[model samples]
Target chain A: MTEAHSQRPGVEIEFRSVTKTYPGQDTPAIDNLSLTVPAGDICCLVGPSGGGKTTAMKLVNRLIDFNEGEILIGGSGVRDVDITALRRDIGYVIQQVGLFPHMTIEANIGVVPRLLGWSADRIKARAVELLDLVRLDQNFAKRYPSQLSGGQQQRVGLARALAVDPPVMLMDEPFGALDPITRNEIQDEFLKLQNEIAKTVIFVTHDIDEAIKMGDRIAVLRQGGVLAQYGTADELLGSPADEYVADFVGADRGLKRLSLRLMRDLVKVSGENHAAPADAPTVKGSATLRTGLSVLFASGSRVLKVTHDDDSATVIGTVTLDQLQDAVYETAPKAPTDVVVAGEA
Target chain B: MSFPTQVIPNFSGPNCAGQFFCWDWVGANWFSVLQPALIQHIWISALAVLFGLVISIAAALYAVRNSWFEKGFSALATFLYTVPALAFFLLMVPITGLNVGTVLIGLTGYTLLLLFANTVTGLRAAPPETIAAADGMGLTRNQVLFKVQLPLALPSIMAGIRIAVVTVISLETVAAQVVQAGLGTPLFNAQRNVFTTGLITTGLLAIALALVADALVVQLQKLVTPWVQARR
Candidate 1:
């Protein structure tokens, strides 16, 4: 992870005392909101509707201009560049996916690149590359958006956003509409994709669980667009600043936190190489601690075998319930506090 | 009297000289008169639709951006549409001097209400999410309007054009009242002379021309919006 972080390139987005008010509204939708997402970090802005979370994301790309203060991308004001050029350089995904129904998947993915004036050949090449990056088949590119399933359309939407290889991404509930199984599938794929791309992402979602799962840093916003708390997901769930955030994180935060740790991180290597127990339940090293715990309980076992395939499926280690609990507590603080702040300044 | 008789040859009932229809008269006039009228009818209708489309699209785009403009333009187009076609043609004759100009101006006005209303509806019908996505991706105002909004609105716009073309084709026949061109001139002459074959041939040909124009527009719409047809 550290090695990947060292190589990742991304832009920093800073919102300094930003405020946006709709016409004829008495109160500002976003009132003096301030936050910062460091380069190569996924900062999830989680809040209820009308909490200004979506509005805050929009302000980043200047989709909706702010009434006061400024938004800076990579230390430069968003307004400094031409609007189209600025947009071309920032990837954007929405809940609806908004894939142009008229265009084929290839054309949809190539939109930003074409807007940037790339040649036809270059755009086609980039479209194929993006389809692969988003884990979609190249053949799918020629299909129209209407022909794609909901999950496929979302993937294409993500591919289109990444077409220009923009360093920053503004995602407004990109997976909010999918069914739970597909949503989880795409979210996992998105996380894997982020590892390769390392974009500075400002993701907005009303789902706190999703935010906790995907965000490197989570910003909890209240009704008036107030930044109630901003910190690592562990910190936000472990210690919410107020009742509003506490309720938002919900009662099952402990289980949610288990999702943050991997079984590999909690596995205890056995000193003696023993023959594999045929009856012992096996969990992949890549499985979440939560899944390992579930398998342990379901199989009525004190310990579960951790298997990872290098050449063949071999028992690499064992993870006991005790070790899983200890590992969870031990690694709780280890969640990167790269920029953990409590309340707004 | 002989000139009228030569053009019509027979004014009587269904079967004249034991023939069901005046095939001879139609064949004779096909090159000399009816053929020219068919060409002129097509020319006038095509010009009216072309000019009307340009004007309406421009107005609709503008109206989509401004609510006041939408309301004002719509009301004006409706007013122009409500004006009797014959009266409007007659009104333009004084200024246009019984030329193609008088007929085209009136026909264009008749098309404006349908085209303008549909264009506005189409432009406004672009999904909000789609518009936001386009804008968020850094498309300029013009690019969004043209590349995103316009293309998405094309299905509705094409429907409007189809209706407008058929309407203009039928209306161009009215142009024959003032100018001696189009299928209407022969049909009117047949009515005056009570020539059964000339009336049937001209009336049937006018319907056929409108249907042909309509079919061509439908094909053009399908060609441009393959995505729409492909969905089905």
Candidate 2:
């Protein structure tokens, strides 16, 4: 399996027993942190302020040194590499957008490339391509940072990060400073960009909602830089590691789970219901229960006919609330294995 | 009624237009007497201002982020300022007697007093956010100091330069007393001759030079500080 995985190229970022402590501090900022983020997925670090989420993100690029441990990018130690070269090889976006007020957007995006000594023509072309990638016009390239709105400045920041076309990206609350509407727009746009690029990303945020929306895996951090929990979003949501994790996830764990829980895992029916309608209410395989609920409500049908998009929206089975609770508790006897198809209604 | 005729002395003398103070003396020697020294004074003052500005900016950049360096430079410059100009020139007279060197050193030392304070003040005037933003962008220390801090600190730095320029020009006249040249020498020469007209003309010319240099610095400041320009 390892060889098969190694046959293909991928970025794997790992922190091994990393411990960081500031002088005169009672505790380490990051205490014995060890986590793995596989390539082509967004691994979010979410927790309250001073949770070491930002510190963990910074360590990925060696912005802050890890005192007791090593961090590996694609399985090589970061300390072994030159910091400037290493940083140039990884994309970084911070909350404040940090656009150089003195330089044009094109120049800002072209910074790392210029440092790497790319040709002026190539750098300009890459700058234009990155601007378009981040959903900005090439016409805006000549404008200074002061001419841009905060959201626009952030797009430029993202473009600048992506300038060198690195395989790994570190984001420290990239959308945290924007308004809610703009934040969502940028987040959605970033996700789209990430999907196409497939870069291994470590994103830090104080928002659990954003974590659930963006993370393939979520690492919940606690005060004093402790890892409260690290698992799939569903795993953490369905079964919190501890009270600290639970509280950090907040009182709306069920609602969070609605987004995390697959429709297949959450759907259930009574054992006695052998006969089913051919045209019962069903949701698309990709639809969340939040969407499923809305469909079920709009259809005015208690029994939801779960349909799969690729499976031609065929009615597979019906799901009711009792089954949902049983599925949540995992108390129901296992259903027939062939009864529901994966990614099928 | 016998009113006593009281003799009141005429304290306000008759207006003698050209008897003692000849207005024509100013027009005749305005270019000859005042022009060369005034031009030289302007050049000397400008050069000293330029030199002082460069040193101050360099020192300020080094000092702003490092507390020890800032304190050291400030303390040393302050000590230099405390030495009286006359005593400083007299001390320099033995080494480099009665020439431009004596004047230049005295004026340079005076300039540092204003320049050092201004440089430090200008650097501190930059917002902390600006520094953080530069760091967040992965700008090197030198890049942040030059590209962000220096530009942001320009107004304060210029203000200091202007103050230093004015102070140096004024001090240059005092240095002139020791050097035996410049506007001060001419005023002393006129005082020796007891010619009130020459004194008035030379004094007016010095004041005019000071005003012109001051106005020019202000214009240069406006040209450099476009951000502050927008604020106004």
Candidate 3:
């Protein structure tokens, strides 16, 4: 059974003209949606409540079935696969974390594996490996979910989803219930974790900033479940499809775009004449341009030294506000009239 | 009064008789009749509750899947509960005869309302998010019912069972009228013969039995649901 779904690099998810309408509702919840999440990419579906963002995600796992059209996982129609087997192969994490209260962390994480009838020793080994993957202490495996903090519970939720090492994962506002500080902290850790695993992920959220921060590609849905735009984060922010997309992305589109670029990407090679000033604030090369900009403002300095730590902290270059601004514009050129025409048409 | 030697009917020291209290009568009859009655009472009540739980859980699982069934079954259970216990036993006697069967049928009917209603309520009370999570993770309908929903509903279900057990214990005493067993037999016999000692002792024992059953069920609930204790 395990060999049947032996880990592929990542599976692509395709939604072809799919629609969902709840009983007795005149309008469909998901209206003729067509989108694709490429292999090994995180595609975020974001919109206001009642926009069918969640409905679209549920259709992937068939938690709820679609009314029309096909939802394909790796080119095979979802209807063709045994649903339980399909679900076991696709990881799912939710905002509430739904860790079984009666079960210990180890048992909760090993649910899918146990359901697949893996050996006891194999399940225990998998649980230990997952706890470490989620950056949790191994001792946590023996504790119940009630003993953990909210953020910790969410990590356990992720570990449980990843138990079978499924090539695809569906996350519905996974960090939506946490405090802002914890949410930010988890988001950073989550991005770092994603880099190592690289599962094909379909992330659903109402928060656009979170989408911008996490999505490799984004599908913006409107209230009637219509797809407003499907593009890269920079494309959506650089040139929104229409007024709704523009307003939805918010007024600070430029600053949001700055978050997409790293400080290392913008750093200028320091000439011999330009030595780092003693008062200049130093930023790690891996920091975001947004962080670099914030540091520049707080320190009230036009220039800041950027460093990369190999064995020791070595100053690599200096970055200026003008340089940061140039980097943002360079990536997101002013939208041509033709670009808006292409979006609207 | 200057009465004959036998006139007072042995009203002397601890052997008092015909003195509205009779220790001598109680001592002689306690093991011979009352001990078996107590044991029969416990056995009948335990069986009734066990049967009621099995039937109720099955009905609750069915009811949860269909709203129409839930409404209809709840109405039927309420109707059964409203019938007087004596009337139900008498009604069952025509089909089941004046045996333990008649007594158990009546007692089990009384337990059904609490067990069925609470089982349904407990299952429906499971968090929607938890149910969705279970489904999304590939739990089949049956697996979800047994593994996820049932375990979470245990506390509410246990409370219902505790009430049902205690209620059945008391109701079983009344079964002695038709079945010829249980504590009610001694009380009924004492009433006919005007034996005050037998009546009070049997009544007190029944009450004590019910209290012990309720306490034991409470302990079982606490033991099974460690998570609820941790929350507090």
Candidate 4:
């Protein structure tokens, strides 16, 4: 309970120097890693396979035990709580979906509720409501996992995890198995669902672009449970911590940063009513940095003013090649706003 | 019951007990001699098969849970089955001293070998995913035994029953040698009397009983496993 007050408003999870080592293993899967996830925020744990991202996420739910230190849910130590009771209060979604093949979608989603001893009628209603929330028709509740498409089955998996109305959600590559189009759709649907539910979520993924799009805070992990970097998407992209972080972001860091720097991040420098200069380039405010770069190239300017497409055009902001380069190549800044202003051309 | 005094020469042709007999005897005593033969044969075979199945299932389940016991049980069943039918009955005579109980014990022992092997194989064949799914559902061990593994292994277990039923029919004849009466005793006596037509009639009756019983088993299988049929 004392930890709850320390967690900023809406924060529900805290992991304190947790470590786990299996017998006969030379190195621990997670080695003294600590992180606090505030409530109502998407904190993505991103790293390549074998990194401790999944281990860190699982510790919050106590799916795996920690050898040292502790994990807390809503300020209570996970170790002190009963496992089944704890799991019922925290939602978990895996990449495989792990849907019960023999049960209908409704029964699958209602599993936690049934375990919690809810009345039969209430469980059924909740199952239907969850199905609808996931964008599936109520009629499909009776269908088995095989009857639903992979995306639909994954949606049902999410619904099942959310059935008990847990305050914390841990998702491990939830969309990793789907085709691109379906993955994007599920991600968008999840975001909408999260906005309404506002659960403190720890989402794990290896995809940097996905982390940028879906995470409010991204924790990049290295092998051996090392913390490569932990910051907002803009901070991570505009300023990686070291060569390891930069390399993990890959060689196309410039392009990756373009997607991370939203128009709002560069909005303060807009020169209102300023007539367009002959050498200046123009880009739509909504355009990504990659697209903005094309406009800058055609006009041969270092800076581009981003404007609304409406007839009564609104000046949103200005961006430059230096800011783009800073976001693409700079190290983790002590303060993100400082880099935003200093990096401006 | 001794078959109603066979009206010899009235049923079979002029020579009375010749090799090629007439159908007259079958029509005359169909309700008496034939009915008891059908009832007694069916009773012994059904009871033996059921007893064998119950024993096999318990043994198989125990084996599944303990690898150490499996080898010993497998050896025991094999040893019991190797004793020839007549020898098995003759061995039982001293213990039970000649009665239906002795006949049942001998047939039950003979059927165990077939049932035990099939049952072990069937339970082992249960899909790993099915077991994992049940575990994930939090079903208790007994629920898993009766609900998941038992139903999944039903077909293989049923095949074992079929094999046991056929074996019981043949073994029950040997069992009759230890008892005062059975379908086998009448045939055995007729062969000694050199009444060849009587031999032919009992042989035909046993074969007919086997055919009918096997057909009923097939029917029961279809009824029990409609899901398999639907899948096919």
Candidate 4 lDDT over A171-270, as tens digits, reads 8898999999999999888877676777788999999878877887889999888788888776776677989987877777667666654444554433
Candidate 1 lDDT score at position A68:
94
The better candidate by DockQ, 1 or 3, is 1
Worst ten-residue run, lDDT, model 3 chain A?
A336-345
The candidate with the higher TM-score, 1 or 4, is 1
Give the runs in model 2 whose Cα sits over 4 Å from its true position.
A1-10, A24-26, A137-139, A260-287, A294-345, B1-23, B64-69, B82-87, B124-140, B187-215, B218-232
TM-score of chain A of 1: 0.83
lDDT for B230 in candidate 4 is 38
Worst 10 residues of 1 chain A by lDDT: A336-345
Off by over 4 Å in 1: A1-8, A21-27, A267-284, A299-332, A335-345, B1-20
Best-to-worst ranking by lDDT? 3, 1, 2, 4
Give one digit per residue, the lDDT tens place, for model 3 in B1-232.
2222332221132454666666565555555676888998998999989998999999999999989988988898899899987778878888999888788888888888999999998888878877777888998999889888888888999999999998888877777777787888888777776767767778888999999999999999999987777741
Residue-by-residue lDDT tens digits, candidate 1, B129-153: 8888898888888888999888988
Instruction: Please name the candidate that would achieve the greatest DockQ relative to the true structure.
Output: 1
Residue-level lDDT tens digits of model 3 in A45-78: 9998999999899999998899999999889999
Per-residue lDDT of candidate 4, residues B18-130 (tens digit): 44675656665566565676678778888888888899889989987898778888898899999988888888888888688888887888888898888888777666644
Q: Is the docking of candidate 3 incorrect, acceptable, medium or high quality?
A: medium
Tens digits of per-residue lDDT, candidate 1, A1-345, equal: 323222436888899999898999988989998888988889999988888998899887777889999999989999899877888888899999888888888998888878777999988877877787778898897788878889999999998888877889999999999999999999988887787778899999988888877888999988888888998877766667878877899877667667766665555332433444678899887677789999999999878888884522677777777766764454335534221221100
What is each candidate's DockQ, to 2 decimals?
Answer: 0.65, 0.12, 0.49, 0.12
Candidate 3 Cα outliers beyond 4 Å, as residue runs = A1-8, A21-28, A268-282, A309-314, A331-345, B1-14, B18-24
